[model samples]
Target chain A: MIFTRSTLMVLLLTVTFGVSFALLSPIFTDAQLEQKTFVTHSGRVIETSGEVLDPVYTVSTVDFDPDEFLRNFEYGRISISDNGQTIRDYTIIAEDDKVQEISPGVFFNVWTFNGTVPGPTIRATEGDLVRIHFINNGSKSHTMHFHGIHPAEMDGVFEIVGGNGGQFTYEFEAGPVGVHPYHCHVMPLEEHIVHGLYGVFIVDPKEGRPPADELVMVLNGFDTDFDTENNFYAANTIPFYYQHHPIQINTDQLIRIYVVNMVEFDPINNFHLHGNLYQYYPTGTDLVPSFYTDMITLSQTERGIMEFQYDYPGKYLFHAHKVEFSEKGWVGLFLVKDNSTSEAYYGN
Target chain B: METSEKTSRIKVVTSGIIPFVFVVLMVAYIFGPGADLLDLGVPLPELTIEKIAFEKSEIHVTVRNTGPLPVQVVMADVNDRIHPAAIEPDKFLNRYETALVRIPFEWNEAEPYTIGLTTDDGTRFERNIDAAAPALQMNFEFVVFFAIIGTYVGIIPVMIGLLWLPFIKKISKSKYHFFLALTVGLLLFLGIDSIEEAFDVSLENLGGSFNDVLLIATTVVLSFLGLYYVSEKLTGRADSLRISKPVVIGLMIAIGIGLHNFGEGLAIGAAVGLGSIAFSTFLIVGFALHNTTEGLAIAAPMSRGKLMIGKLITMGIIAGAPAIFGAWVGGFAFSPFSSVVFLSIGAGAIFQVIVIILKWIREEGDKNLSSAAVAAGFATGMFVMYATSILI
Candidate 1:
């Protein structure tokens, strides 16, 4: 085909502009308008149902179940010592940069022992030699400080272990049979404690107590905004988690709860049970009951063992007596089921 | 020969060792101390609420993840009360990802409400609406309200400025070119003003990633070239009995001024929609005064041509009515990117019209480029615009 120079120039310009425009159009267009499917870190392609908004909210498949935490206890590896003494060896790894979702949508940098806030509960019998092989994989220095009796050198406060793969062995006799708190005893203790560095330590007597449905409840608070005051309070790490997923228990069975108060920046926290009273041991130091009450106030790290039985199958509420704390998520419900009947009764 | 054989064997053994050593070193570099040394702390999540649309018994929130980490919207809360929300696409958002969260909430109008979203990491992001109101809909009342505002801001003001046509027609032939030069000066100011407004809007409302400067520049160039092409086609038909060259330039001036007024209307409507600025009689008066000078610019080019009342009125409407459409869109769905685009186009159109006016002035046999009367008229045109703008 014969063409003038101007016509040839126009054709060349048209092709160039068309190709460039086609390539550059996507840059100016809204990305949210396109429906895109993304593969998650676990290699799962997620499909969504229902009307999606202009920009879809990313829902997480990862869930933190508090049910397992309620009844979990770490007794450690058991063995006999050289001198015929019972020895319990435990490996507690301290990490300072672990990010945990303490509640829906809230992620906090929690310094953890064994990778969990209000770390694992360490249980041991009286006079058993407790050997904790501590590894600090965190960015900051840490130490295992037990609230029970130990040698001066064994105290975690003085011998500050260095950070980034620092190691320390804490060998101590589990004395004064009671419920105590084991936490990071690094200087500026509140900073360590508030970021979830503490856990429960239960030392039974030479002879164990009566068999019961035992559970651990660690009272803690998160200062999300770092304002020195807690924004949310909870039994475990997640706020209102237990309230949404009520703890199931059987009626007419003895229920023992190892309650520990580890909330910092607050003077005291109290627990109140609805429609129930129980025999409370002040520190579980003695087998005898200290008091019978529906509510009990505790200071920081104060702990006790409560033994009770519900005769009727129903839902009961348990929460902090402090209105502010309870209102801000320190609440839960216990769903007591009748063991005699096959049908479950769920109470609102 | 024995030495040569030994050397070959050594070379073979060294080649084998070299690869093995390299493999071990690569593995160590990737996964050993090197990995541990490069360990950066946990990625932080940031959520930004882009827009909130209040519907009947529903609040639709547009949220974007502006951080490096992926975030999941696990829960929604209205005034601290948990409400089940249906999130579109998925609740998990990668960095720079957007999500639409539709929450069924019974919100009272005029009452303040706080909407909170909780991510999987327990971070609560909250947005507060000081006064709750339904999003603007294309209803009868909405159309009438915008029309009234547009009429005051665009149409009436331009018609008032066109009252200068009789005075312009009575001037001597020697002084006639002065008015055309003045029209150029007025358009030049309007063109610069439109560009400045476009840039301001882009800077304030558009995100950094949009590259608003490039977008505005591209739109201006495209609009200028487009108008120039259309004017060239009109010039080809100037010999016909229907439209003349002067009339075409006059029409171009009206179209350019119309576009500029539309942008102005958008600003006013958006301010009212956001409740940032109140709609008052004083504001209307200020805007009317500011826009009257636009009509004078449009009429100046056609002063020497044959006058027709119908043509004049048509040009006036062409120059004015787009403000109504602008008001409607701005009051309902005010998007910053689109605003920047339209303002740039207006600036481009104005500049194109100015070029045609200058060319016509030179064609009229005014060989001297800078005459005293022409310079005085141009300065007067700029001064008039500045004086009117102070009221706004």
Candidate 2:
């Protein structure tokens, strides 16, 4: 009896509910979401944090000091008496908490690009030319390089940051689509570049793509004066700073990534994309027609672009190739959802 | 009172003769070099006498998320070729998904021609027309209107087969495992092909989900067999004996039925082809109804007097008739692959049913003759459908 009554009521409700849902659901997002970030305040806050999963890759926190980073980048100077700080201070957390120990004192003093590691991820399409305009307010000279796509003139070989700083533009028609890294190509390659010159770049193919999301990580390491063994950083020296953040994307979208490395001694880096394999190869250099892969590795100045659709939604990781790279400095995580995963039983 | 006896005797005479008439029709349908009794009319030549401009790129396009979540409109275009879109059911089409993606356009002058639209599913909708001229803002919407419809239509045939359960109650209570298994195979293949046809999707697309559909489809077949087997075992022996003359007569009926049903999808194809939009809709509904009752033509006689050969022959006619119809219709319908699906499925199911009947005959030690008859039954069923595919 109860079932019968409920059945009729439920039947009526289903139609009403279905019609309401259709009427309410929007088919497309507004254009404003795609626009670049705008500064609301005069001040800046950088994020700092990191983690370590393997010896080859290390994730440490960037102190996220906007002054040090802002000084090296030429966005704009914030006034002391202005509206407020330009950047917001934030924390970068790791999936596996406390991967590595930082030098000096407390285990945490997380570093972030503007307080976030890998700086705010630089996003661009396959054909779009990307410009990395940077300023070096820090005492040392710095450089930048991208991993996903290759640039003709500026491969980040020279010091990208010194005096008033400089800009590097990355241009290419397209490549195998996937997530890739960018970093300073400067020598001693591990030390200076690793200090904080890394990020990700994504290149999405024009057709038959998949659903994907991105997470960015840039490994940072410093030869602190207190380190007893200069060689110890190689075996297990902790990172001084690091950055981590996520890149949300459209549903059924092919996941594309651009990563860079800034550390010196660690000239080589790898990007492991969890879950779905990267569907496209950047640099127009792929061995197979349907080359599907889980991770992409590159050296300083090299960027690999990855494209893949997320058939299933879930939270996954995108991190450095070198195990030690993640141990102290390089790591990031992203969440992918399309409402289907809203229910519990629908996942692996 | 005298008329009643005569009427009963005449009914007997006619019932006995009906099979003969069926046989003659079958021979004519197959050997008669292409002819259809329901040759209603050449759909295009008869109807659609207006000019409407359809090909102007005034083709305005709008992507509506009539679905729950917003969808990024990928690619939209008008294709010339008419290819049947297959939906791999396992394909993860999200909910409250984007449906009815419209490509709006206006023609400077209206004219008559088949208008077609291609969607993500690969299914195309085509219509024939004679139009006034091209006009401004002519709406040529390429709405993927069938995704939801496909999902729902997927339930119909299964519901029909299920509705038949109470009536098809089995005869004996004794265990008939192999017979049951054979029935399971026949239905399993039939539903798979039907669903496969329905979705325009392939089993191969289910990255990992293929196994799941396989298991479910098998279960449905097995469940039906199990219930029937249990029921038959409890009741009594099924009429599995052969009446030779009747067997031949049943074979004839099988052929005739095959002839008539062959054009089942023709109306839909022709309606769509000639741009009879309203009729095209009517045709799909009408044919779907026509197929549901088709199972009974053979099933009814088999129930009245169970002849293994008769059942096999009936299955052939029931299954093969549609192919011939489909083949004929496919010509004007502009979809050639449609017959392949109908043909393959018709063949698979009939082949399965024949196997079941042959096994029973074999166990009884019926001579090689019965085995030969079973083979003939299977072949005739498949051949009639195969032949019908082109008869159109």
Candidate 3:
């Protein structure tokens, strides 16, 4: 009887300690997400001399990579499907391509998705059905695997691969809205990824995001020497393309950038915008902005949407915070011209 | 007769109606104006430890808010010999979402540290972490390879020897008793060793925190009690068919030793993952020698003439296979919580086996040896195990 009582006492003490510890512990809730306001500006006035002042650009139909047309592609306002079902159908081809001058005079061979490093950004509203038809035109077998909730049978893998010159269809419901990445999950995955068989998949919120001049930027890199290491990195596979041809935006307009880190070899990359603070939406899944910061860090395949309005007209530079990555090729400039003047000049 | 009937009716009505009335009143008090009177409007925040990692030099915790409301994290503090300053991650974990809190403290891997977190909702969470091998430090390929090799290395010789156990049955009964006693001594040493290792997690500061000490103690006591209860419930009933007590005891020892060996495998695997090749090799050698004796221990009780070869082989597998599995797991992720839990349970199980063997010896009435000889044999067993352990 004494032993049983003692055992009960011990058990009681243990239970009390556990419950009290849970209630009184401090480490569980030490951090908080606080809101902070950054500096803001009005609009800007710019005087131009026969220069293009629009962030918009026409898709080059005859380019080596046709998916370059998707850069400024508009994914309009989000809404429920009229038929109460949102079905997004897509087809991608995996093939080898020897491209010329990723950067000036830097020729390289790459395995491409839709003839581009980062296939194409597939966009859809929440609750939409995403159907991807994948074709493997490459000599070696390849498969498409997406990073999101999906059925096992629909997960594009080697066993279910449409082998070389074969076709396979992957279908799933667009979910609990977030930014997701799709890539070749074939063995020798790193080789295929480094060579370029990847893309971004964006699921917009059901309620839709606030209006903005949206743009898609998929950060990627190239292994010039086939050494399993990247020698050059780019925002859109076109190395230094943004620097040579800067993206133009109007001052005082909300600029939303959908950025993705598709760099294979490196573990992390970051976006640091000069002289601007933006509301960061982690994975585009959150209903409200999670963070407001000028610099956003992400690991490989971590993608998100960033929103900010350029109040003054000046060159806003954006690049990987890793100086080496920026120095190689992952840098761009946003030319924010005076909205009133550009509009009048263009007679809009 | 009427008065008695009336008394019985009153008893039944009172017995059922009083509790019903009490429950109704209590419910009304709780849900009605009692809520206003008590001012219990605020819901308590429930914080759960979703994940933890000692990555780089700092501790990273993924905390989840399982409650309906969001929680504000106030401070993250670590308590040890060198108590670190409280770090305010200053983050809010939303309902059904996770927030990663980075605690700025250099972990002393050898010492157990209690991490405490406080929230705005007046709830605190405390977790004990002893050792953490970051994922970056782990080499999965080498871990799996060494784990496989270590498993076979530790028990293959014993397994092969089990194939030749038929000849051993020809030996004398006294020899069997000596071997059994020696095996008990080895296991006793192992149980003690395991307990000591588990005790290390508390940094040997038994007085400072009662909880850690209580955890290890309770695990030992409960594990023994659980096994005893299970065995008794299964076999002690008079209606049940009789099973050989020695066979049951042998299987129990093998299982207990298997758990113990799994812990050793984890250590070896972790060593490999940490890139300490020499240490892993030494551990493999020590564990292999240790396991050979364990094989002997398993076969010690099997003096029953009808022991099948297949059963012996199965026993060998049971005693040995878990080490490889442990090594594989350790290579990928190493958590001190699992280590302590496994070791404590193993110690408990081994301790129970010791009790059983001693009970059998007492019942059999050892005419072959005096008390001094028994003591000497037990001492020799402990000494041999200790000496072999030092090699690792």
Candidate 4:
């Protein structure tokens, strides 16, 4: 009886201490976290002057032969800096496309980008001109199709003929700011896009990104059949590089994220964040400050923008909701910084 | 290890009409003037970990899965200082995602410094990351804290229930089975959803090992579970069937689970290779679900074994060991082909389970059947999705 009473008392005391300690934990104050400036302006990526095609090797990054020059390149992205400020990563081909370096999966009998068979997240904002100048380097025919947004002539559906070595200027007057996915809508789409050929198109909010910081991300997949590093996924694929990017944030500040699904065709894209939630625009429209959550599901050819404020700051993580996706490689991260009010509390 | 054992000793009885107490508490807390103080909420932590990086060095950290269920992870402070942050990514980091949160500090001059590592659940875990001395890689392992969570969800409920339930009214066999079913259901749901949810990653434009490996790995895990379920059902129950080698069959099931988890590990490896700590987490969760169910599956059969404790522990390993291995692999030396092998294996397991359920249904179509109940359950699940979707 004495032992039992002592044990109960000890347990009660411990719990009390723990609960009080937990409750007393200070809330993140502005002085504790790091805040960045949200700067949004116009960016133009045009070959109008025809000075340099940027002479980029439009091929799958997995197939990007560093030792050997990009000769008859199968696929890749056009690394044209948007206004020379940011590299507007754009997919260009298929076949030679790739998945992760560790698990290299290649989809044959298809045409797609270099990284993901479906390609990466292609982001843009409302009123932004989504202009594509393709040189048609594939064997057969191919065209671009905007699944999320609409276009009268060059929606790039199967109707257009993109034969061998042919090129076309695919342009879309940016529609309502939202997330839109574009894919290769040629014959046997399952094969064309399955191999590699797609990207994400994120149309920003009509006004602009939320007042919080802005992080535009492009997620996709690849198919590099021979690498042995990535050969699990047959069609859709997320590249190794995106997975290579780390997501870090400040705990005491607000954040706005633009996440778009660019894989030409595949898997339910469930984007989730750890330890934190976000206010999102479903169907990629109408953002209310209260739509806060940690997970957001994106269907094929979909886009979403998440915004939220951080009151508690600590180490946080973000990634795909799919358990195995990370193993195969679709993942990213964000780090939170210590945003404390003053050192007086902890004596730091 | 400890939490699972503790949860088994739970019992709940409510002679005091606990619901009334709950109502009173609710009224007192919600309607009372000091509601916030009396409620279950407490002040959230103020220290935010953001843009915390080895601004002058490279940091390598690994978060492990040590929980009964999967939990989400986000950006941790210490090694973060990015211009913009992706905090609360609309997704979760599964069980064992590890990341090298490197700031890529190119040292033009030598300086003394340290790196910080953070876990997603506000667990401020850090490592003294140093990179100047021949690129020394600092490794940090995650603490699952599964035992802690289990204590609250399982043992606490059982203890409270036991307090009110008549001491003479020990739990009945059927009640135990019902509880088992509930646990199974929860685990199964967690397993399937976690695998699906964990692997279903969608990045804008950049796709490769991350999505492909993860997708295939997760699908395989799902199929393995399915096949195993089906196979067990087809093999018949322990009562009437005289299997030539029951032990072999059980071992084979265990092996199949192991193989599938290995693939999940590969996915984790690939994610980590690309510096993705979040996706690794989901892989861990999927593996945990896979492991826990395995434990229950074996435990049900070995209910009467010499040293029941030993057998249960062994069974838990049979189911859970693979996950731990996979987590290590994913966090270390995982690959994609493993995902394929595991996917096929998991497919087999799932088929086994499905087969079992199908045969049972066919044999007892009307006996003890509750069509309304099943339909209601299905409707309820669908309604939740619909409601959430609508609200969003």
Candidate 5:
């Protein structure tokens, strides 16, 4: 009764057209949108593109306070506005510390560098000479084996360890701008890495990529039970740290994330960006990005730089795509907002 | 003149007999020996001998749900005799959902067997199936064929909603509000259900610690506040009490329901892939009913304005296409943790909608507000949803 004569005619035409289209869809359907394609070799493409609708630029202060470890944690682009800087100097001390809890009552005995799980990020421009003074204040011998281009003599190995309070000054050129991770190169590498003697090294591109809000994330895990498997995983040595004190990024600017996976026992780790895809520079080594993807897998010691600008303001989730890791602790949020309205809620 | 009169009389007799025969046939088909043909509001199950292989000692029987309702298949009988080999314990068959029912009956190539399927609904369908009538084969072509079919069935609710839009103008404003209240009531049920499901996951896996509890709590609060901020921004108002724009609220409601349906689709797709065909079938029936009610929620608010047909179709797609997408992925790779996250997000979004609806109701002013009617509508919605859920 609701179908008038013209409406009925239109309905009949639609049905005929709809059936015809369904039958012919395969011939016309593009393999990209109309068909499902899973890339096994390359990373998954969750979302294709992100565009910044409006550009608003203003200086805003965001508090990074959570715990002492998070408060002291350093991120962002190196202040190399003066390219005249020729030398980068850094020092790291290896020590053993007992933690009351890794994830709320889960205790662990950690081997740390510079009194933290992931030592301070050493940022330098390409072709700059990097000098590092390494000291082992712990009872056990420790060495810093960096996953980057350097001389073997500067490599922290057991042979060069002076045991308790021994110091070694190593100098090398930081070339091939990329995110690199440095960890203990002792014999039992898995045990040392799981105990938390790892940190990220960011070597900025020579011309320096356009400055945006930069961040350094080191993926590591803890094996509290002495087993080869990790029970607790964290982005920066603290479980659920980002959930408490989320990283803030003002909208209308590109976000650069340097992610390194150093969990020894786990074979593979991945980072999945929720609601965004980034231009991925694998190990930051290439001038041209290899791909633009929302998720990428990292083997042990693998690192990369991701750049993207959010068009909308929201709590964007950044975490290991591995569900187990995310559920346990390897999850964080990027609270993006406008510069005019957003203020530091968790006052540092 | 005499020849013309005779011919006209013959034509009249011919027409009368044909009409009488057609009426008798339809009545018999609907109510008598041919009842299975119409099926009539009951689930109809059909069985076909799919494939027979030597030395396998089992014959694959394809149990198909051909009716509009899901049926719990209690037993299958061979030649009217109870056979343990023919019945699968705790098996269900969903509407249009098929399963390979294996019976440990040695097949004789020359023999024809009458397979009877008895559903829990007390309806039975019998088929005299030949063991060798072009046996059902599995191949890539068949896989794609079934996938297309599955996808078609998955988006049925969305299609229904789109088709139902033109008549929405006929509904009065008062009726629309009643339906809107009803929609809120159903969403209330859904939001609570989803949250309960998420909390169950947390309790079982997260050990109910402070962080786990806090995670769920914060997700809800953050989702509400985040949407609230967006709404405020859109309306250009700093006041918390300001009513969210109707279109924005409508979209939010649709998005929330879409998320929930996506999760439901994942469950169905995963189940189908895992050979839980009956469970998938039941879910389809359950979710189809739920989605019908959900379509009302999306369309009810827009009754005041003359929306473009294209815009209405887009709204329907946004609200309903997720189920198909979810099913597509879930069929390939099903992850429980991911499902939990989806369900949690859905819960939070729907919770926000519930709050917004309450504010919308309050802003309607005293004269238009009927507390009893709203309450009744809410209870009716809950009842309808609860009733539909029990069928699955």
Candidate 6:
């Protein structure tokens, strides 16, 4: 009877101790983990036990959304021409007096096409008649020069559209089956391009390559201090925009990114995808894939098409391979979601 | 008596003849070729761009004409391309006139833009923005930031110094006079410092538009007379209530110190806004230390009075809150002319308070200002201010 009583007491005590230990362990562990110390760039020391996160996003002073810009393809007002040809009519307005906050507390005056840094992404299929009603509503002369096979007079160069409501019409046949950059071809080309007077022009093959979630990534930079050196870099116009609002994609879904490089005052810029390889189409000129890679280096106005698929559902990073550019607001993230869990996930 | 009257009449006649002869000579000179020589051809239009602001799709260029002749801007250009512009208050600018030229140009950020104004004579006056940046706008966040800065440098430090009131109250009667002398000494130093600062700002920032020396002198005299009149009125009303004379003097000291602190806040806020001074831990601490002595000066005279916590707090606020207004003005819309005027007013207020304190000290049985304690306190007060200033 004494042995049984002793055993019972030990069991009760042990169970009590275990339960108490289990309850108290999480509290201590959480307290340790929650206590965080952060040092700001301005050398302010902050200590917190609760959530100590810098705001995930700052309300941008400029109204350019990178996620919306990614998949926003302007097919223009399509119409059937008298010759039964597909005509894509676009009105490209060039303006020179728009101030944009490229980075936090750093603003830049960005000369724009259609009031945006990269302007609008104009898309056309091969053999289509591309007619652009160009308007210079800015304070400087500008012209839309597309990089493709077109007539001499149809070239944006040599035909300088005057400022203050100057108008011109550019008609051409979309011959080249690839992604091209259309920009202001006025003199002092670098000045026009650097101020964001450039955008993407994708001419799809008549047969069409493949259907995928299409996106546009225009890599650019801003010389905020006007020291002839870029102070900020980003995929779209605003810096660190994509990092704050990550692009969502479904797992195992094919992703097509039409990437263009429009950064001036720099020799080169590059893009690298984390945890995934992509089939790279140099300029998207050919139907077949040229290279399978996770990274690609581009020169000024250099561009390509990237097609990839994620096998696992998780967060991934896509940023400039150039460490300087990436550190200075050129980084972004992709949140790949499991398709089986949510069929209604929208890709950005 | 007849001879003296005749001499006074002759003196008055002689003074009148001098002005009549001067006027005759000036009229002759004006009629002669000398007046024609004064017309030195059409002087060049000297337009200075006071500010460049980018708003929406327009560039607002604030330009001031500092030339002797009037200028008419007929055309405006952006990057050598002529663009239509609307000049407010007329494009015809007379000497010392300012106009806002609004050009509807979609300028890009981080781009170098040269805004050129073509005068009627085809003479182009150009202002180049090295890089276009957004104009600083007043917002709630900016106001809060400046308030926090003012509280750090003004209110908190002054309150901390007021903590010395209990110790001040315990001092002997002989030393009480010494503390009053110290307050006088502190005000005197602050007055001279404010004058010097006002002169410095006028010299460096006012340009040639203002005669800075004249401006400072006139402002100082006006402010001094105004405060003196106000103090006399306050004293008359206080006498009816039978309030202690020292309490009135203490209130005046608070006002004086408050004015000086407002000027100090302006300098700090302007520096921070211009990005010339880094807002660091050391700067805030330094300003706090420098301003603590101002509170001590306010408390020194009040030691003899019945010190109520509410009165002390009111005095503290009176001596400190102006810094917040000053910071707001300096950070948002700093004008050098206003800064100079405010600083001179501060100097004048300080001088007015000094006179009141000295009179109070004399009435307190220290007939002559020759006491050893007074001499030592004055020297110590000046020394404390100088030492604390080194930290800033």
Best by TM-score: 1
TM-scores, one per candidate: 0.72, 0.27, 0.41, 0.32, 0.37, 0.45
TM-score of chain A of each: 0.81, 0.42, 0.75, 0.57, 0.73, 0.83
Candidates' lDDT values, in order? Answer: 0.78, 0.37, 0.66, 0.42, 0.63, 0.77
- Residue B217 Cα positional deviation in candidate 3, in Å, after optimal superposition: 0.9
Of 3 and 6, the candidate ahead on DockQ is 3
Q: Whose DockQ is greatest here?
A: 1
Ranking by TM-score: 1, 6, 3, 5, 4, 2
Q: Considering summed lDDT, which 10 consecutive residues are worst modelled in model 2 chain A?
A: A46-55
Residue B238's lDDT within candidate 3 is: 21
Tell me which of candidates 2 and 5 scores higher on TM-score: 5
Error of 2 at B286 (Å): 17
Per-residue alpha-carbon lDDT of candidate 6 for residues B1-392, written as tens digits (9 for 90 to 100): 99999999999999989999999999899778678867767666566665567666667776666566777665555664444455655666777666667666667876888876655444556767666655546889889988988888888888888888888999886687788788777778888889998988766554455567877887787678677766776787787978766678778888888898898788777765544444434556677897788888888878878977888888898888888887887777766667888898899899999888788777774586778878877888888777776776
lDDT of 1 by residue, A257-306 (tens): 99999999999999999878999998899999999999999999999999
Ranking by lDDT: 1, 6, 3, 5, 4, 2
Model 6 segments beyond 4 Å from truth?
A: A1-348, B1-61, B73-89, B101-134, B277-283
Report iRMS values in order.
10.3, 23.1, 22.8, 19.0, 25.6, 28.2
Q: Write the per-residue lDDT of candidate 2 for residues B60-137, one digit (tens) a residue.
A: 221222223222222222323211111111112243222222222333333544444322222222334354232222
Report lDDT (Cα) of residue B270, candidate 6: 70
Could you report the DockQ of all the candidates, in the order they appear? 0.15, 0.01, 0.03, 0.01, 0.00, 0.01
lDDT of 3 by residue, B184-272 (tens): 78889989988887777334212122355676787788777666555554445423555566667667777777777777777776676
Candidate 3 lDDT: 0.66
Measured on C-alpha atoms, candidate 5 has an lDDT of 0.63
Q: Lowest-lDDT window of 10 residues in candidate 3 chain A?
A: A50-59
Q: What is the lDDT of residue A336 in candidate 4?
A: 58
Q: What is the TM-score of chain B alone in each candidate?
A: 0.75, 0.32, 0.65, 0.38, 0.56, 0.77
State the local distance difference test value for candidate 1. Answer: 0.78
Write model 6 residue lDDT over A48-158, tens digit each, in one string: 443221211332334777878888999989999899999999999999988765554344688999988899999999999999999999998999999999999989899
